[model samples]
Target: MAITIELDDAMASQLRSEAAARQMSLEEFGRRLLAEAMHRIQVSSNWRARNQRRVELIRKSTSAELTAAEQAELDDLQAELYERMETADQDLLDRIADLENTVMP
Candidate 1:
């Protein structure tokens, strides 16, 4: 598919410089960057969906005694959820720092 995007001169120059530094054509660099971003977005969405289901199960278990297997599954999911949340918090802080550098005086 062919699409036309209008980037301001500053952004276009920055992108061109980055592509040149990487020894990649602008199209290839843009494609790789976009593909990586999309993959991250999809992974984040899947993680949220899985975590939501786990949260629901945990909540339900609060109302009744979970079987041994269910309890084990919940324990594993909770650990993973905590780890992911920590990573996400760090990512957010990093992004905030980047934005501050870019836009702050």
Candidate 2:
């Protein structure tokens, strides 16, 4: 899947300058960037797969046929977990946004 693309002189110069500043050859710098990008994509995919499995397990467990008493108890627990997760999500989002605002221009 290797594709050849031409970079105008300005962009090529910029990349060369960046590589030089980092004490890396341009080829090595590009290779490192590509590796990092691939690693990020892989990590993201793994996280998504794990999360999907977790959701599926939760759904299967929750929807099983069970005695009424057991079901009621499970329902109560699930409701509590849902509420806590919702609150945590909001708190996490607020913290992330606050941190971004503080660190980013």
**Best by the TM-score measure:** 1
Candidate 1 lDDT over 11-61, as tens digits, reads 999989999999999999989988999999998899888788788788989
Considering only N, C-alpha and C atoms within 3 Å, which residue pairs clash in candidate 2? none
Q: Which lDDT tens digits does candidate 2 get at residues 1-105?
A: 665658899989998999999999988888887799999799667756655655655676777866676556656656756775798899999999999999995
Alpha-carbon error at 32 in model 2, in Å?
A: 0.7
What TM-score goes with each of the models? Answer: 0.68, 0.48
In lDDT terms, how accurate is model 2?
0.77
Instruction: Note the Cα lDDT for every prediction shown.
Output: 0.90, 0.77
**Which runs of model 2 end up more than 4 angstroms from their true locations?**
1-5, 8-10, 64-105
Lowest-scoring 10 consecutive residues by lDDT in candidate 2? 49-58
